[model samples]
Target: MGLLLSSCVPTSGGLPPFVNPPASTPYGGEYANEILKLPVYPRSRTLDKREFGNGNSRVRFRVEGVNVRMIYNFFTDQIEDAGWGRNRLESEGQNRTWQGVYQRGIRLVRIRVQQEGNSDVYVLEVTFLQ
Candidate 1:
């Protein structure tokens, strides 16, 4: 005989249960500042990023300067340059922002300063949307 709860049971590799709550308040200012203050990221920037670590994740950032390199997964953070090559990004410049999306698996450290210029000081903001 077939089990009555078969339809109600969750199978292996099946989709996870869904639950939705009301939209929350925006996170900015001091609260966001404190999050950036966490031991996850290095020296904070104008738009400090709140890190969320799990396995390995790639952070998406919008930079204004050229020759920009990110310091991802430092020391215990596992921030390395290996995944970057594998997940090479495609950039489409607009205004002062170099827009692109990165995967969720690597901890981003800092934006490596290559050649300094008048506009080299970019407003970096890394958001965790997952």
Candidate 2:
């Protein structure tokens, strides 16, 4: 009878796995105050409409770390794309580092995940640079 009950119980592995920091993964310290504050989730991400290009009010996602990257589409100037950035597993400690002067226009920034591990999601507001 005990064996029957054990088999009937569901396992935790079948459910959504929770993330464990440090050992399993390490999210670098937050930088770029503007991008650090954006609304993001496990499967979906978002941003306010007045943070990026101008202070006139517009939705723009703010993000950081070594997991995702926002690519800019030179043509349409809209972030209709999102995916991974760069891999930190092989580049020692510089895989997720990105540096550049973002263009002054409406460009589609796509978020891309580079590493193979748990994803960290959070929500924040877009504060324009005044």
Considering summed lDDT, which 10 consecutive residues are worst modelled in model 1? Answer: 109-118
Runs in model 2 deviating more than 4 A are 1-30, 44-67, 76-130
Residue 124, candidate 1: Cα error in Å is: 0.7
Candidate 1 residue-wise lDDT, 38-81, digit = tens: 34433325432233234334443333211223444434332235
Q: For all candidates, what are the clash counts? A: 10, 19
Task: List TM-scores for all candidates, in order.
Answer: 0.24, 0.20
Candidate 2 lDDT, tens digit per residue, 18-87? 5333353244345455456754434343332223334322334433322333433334333323332221
Single out the weakest 10-residue window by summed lDDT for candidate 2.
121-130
After TM-score superposition, what is the CA distance of residue 78 in candidate 1 from its true location, in Å? 25
For candidate 2, the TM-score is 0.20
